[model samples]
Target chain A: MSQPRNREQTEQRILAAVGEVLAREGFTGIGVNAIAKQAGVDKVLIYRYFGGLPALLAVWGRSGQFWPRVEDLIAEQPDVLTLPPPERLTRFFSHFIDALRRRPLTLEVLAAELVARNELTAVLEEERERWGQAVATLLGGDDAALWQDHIGATTVLIAGVQYLLLRARKIRRFGAYDLHSDASWDALKASIAAYAQATLVRPEPAGHARQDKP
Target chain B: MSQPRNREQTEQRILAAVGEVLAREGFTGIGVNAIAKQAGVDKVLIYRYFGGLPALLAVWGRSGQFWPRVEDLIAEQPDVLTLPPPERLTRFFSHFIDALRRRPLTLEVLAAELVARNELTAVLEEERERWGQAVATLLGGDDAALWQDHIGATTVLIAGVQYLLLRARKIRRFGAYDLHSDASWDALKASIAAYAQATLVRPEPAGHARQDKP
Candidate 1:
């Protein structure tokens, strides 16, 4: 019993450490040594449990940390099929953007994963699939209205923060995108929600699949 | 008279050389020797005409090979006061994007310029007055909208291709973001236009300013 608890504690510590390092230094700054040190876990145990930065991040990247906090706003799982398109779509998108705001660390890791271009790509791809499912589910729980374009607009809207960060790296203009400010967060939530509402309500036919092979 | 025309030809030749080198190699890859060789201009004259890459790029970066195409779309000398609210805004944005599509080289240079940071940022800062005026004209043709969120969004949207390229750099799983593909370009143009329309129309009553800077 004690062993299980100890193992859980160790894993949590490691994850917390990884989160801190990623939030602070981002992907370029994160390493096995940094994670272990921050977690206060033995470096070897980190290897044993998480494999490496890639594996550790795979779990982090693929998990529910990226999902919005819908439970707080909605009483229960939305019967997406039956709900009026506007409220259902708006609320769901609001929840989605809210979720990203709730987990800025997830945003950080996702961007880092995006740029890492390494073994993490598979994990990121899986996360992308999960995100699509999440968005599709929000679209109608299978009754998606204009799902394809809604998804494209959603991708761009949600991607705003990550995109800003990339600009920050190139220009080294920190604070250009302050993800933490409450007003800033509200504005982000508003911008995406506005975009999503505009996008999901319309009746655009499904166009061709993206020419992008990947 | 022939000598003056020859001098004009010499200046044009050197500027053309800058654009070519930037297209073939990224910002990191450009230097003095290559520019002279490519331009078929004497190495010494490069210094004489433009001083160096910094000066040459400073000039070229402003109204050179790429932007003129982009600028042609918007009425450069518009009577700002006469233009209507969203029409001026969306038209300016659409035209700017159209211009970006007209010449592939601008996106390439802008992409490299954005990522390269230091020197380019200084150049961008120098051009801020001109950029601001042009962007402000697009926002509403009025001075009020210039200070708000719309300009930032527009600038970022203008910078969207760079964001796409940077993300592509990470995945390494696909081809380039073709600015010319009708579907892709149309979608991109629509999104930006839609965003501009939404941002500028029925904008908040004049005096509101975001309290927090992000």
Candidate 2:
């Protein structure tokens, strides 16, 4: 193989190894030596290519399972934007949940962010902002206050879903819902979708007193 | 101090020391020797009295700041149960946030639960069930299905608040909300409260169609 091709392959191997280790052991297992061992590459190569573990993990998040699949969803369903605000949000929530569920590493990385601050957090924040902008646009510039409120609500909703799933991995069951079971998962998604749809509609400005509307 | 009295004093000192260590160095700083050193107690006593660090931490959670204060709030405001569900929930959210803020150690303990499983998590889980029962009572036992939906929604709301505040300790800001500031925190609490109230009144049953009401 050519010299440059070998370097590129080495970098790819390191990134892939990071994902595998992240899946198995979460953020705790993503040390420099572990990545090198998993990749079967020299330790020097990790530093030479990625600079450090934080940067490497961030790269893995950006290029690995989560974002790539999200991008494809957006590409495959370009007309998702044309749907009503609530419908668009429901679709987005479903896609986002599926992505996180498939790539458990994403959820682990998010859990790690709660305890520690690193370069990876910035990437997470930026990706969150991208989704925020997408959701914000769904309101279509009607009532500024309501738009802002829904944006904040959306942030909480996303964080809530992620946190519940993270805990579900450990505790298995909370309240009457069984996180380990498929039926409960489907119920969770449906309930959140309905809730997201309802939150965006602001018939009344302040009290949400219109909440009893049939 | 007499022998039994001395033993009681040592246990109290050890529990207080755990809080100090949790606040100062976080869960990573917590260990058998470190607690003994901080409390000026013997390592043998910690094992003898509390059985281990996990049990000690669990004792601290049950006796120390957060849950104890919350129980007082419930006790002090006997009228809280009689008020409308929305009012009761808002009050509960406010008190819960205050308890968390006042006892930053509780937040640290919760963050620790994310990475490690110990006796502390079981205490946390039990506390969660207590609150869940309280919220369920407010549903008035009218519709079983609606009750379950609200239970799930309430779980998400609590998790969202906890996750945001946990992240605030590290990242300081998320989206447009500043988790560290009073104004932003109040805004978050109010938004969640309103969202929670809107969720319970299931006028349309399936779609939460009343959500758009003023």
How many residue pairs clash (N, CA or C atoms closer than 3 angstroms) in each of the candidate models, in the order given?
A: 1, 4
Candidate 1 error regions (>4 Å): A1-17, A39-83, A140-155, A161-181, A184-214, B1-133, B142-162, B172-182, B191-214
Candidate 2 at residue A139, lDDT? 39
Model 2: per-residue Cα lDDT over B39-81, one tens digit each? 8777888889999888887898787545434455456577665
Docking class of 1: incorrect
- Name model 2 segments beyond 4 Å from true: A1-8, A42-77, A138-146, A196-199, A202-214, B1-11, B41-52, B55-65, B68-77, B138-149, B196-214
Error of 2 at B22 (Å): 1.1
> What does the lDDT read for residue B185 in candidate 1?
49
lDDT of 1: 0.55
TM-score of the second chain, each candidate in turn, equals 0.60, 0.75
C-alpha DockQ of every model: 0.11, 0.43
lDDT tens readout by residue for model 2, A1-214: 2235588888998989988887788777778888888888887888888888877877876775354244544555788766666666677777777767776666777778777777777777778667555555543444556567666566777777777777776777666677788788777778777776667665656654355424
Per-residue accuracy of model 1 over B31-115 as CA lDDT, tens digit each? 8888888888777778887777788777776655345432465556456345555456556655655565555565455455433
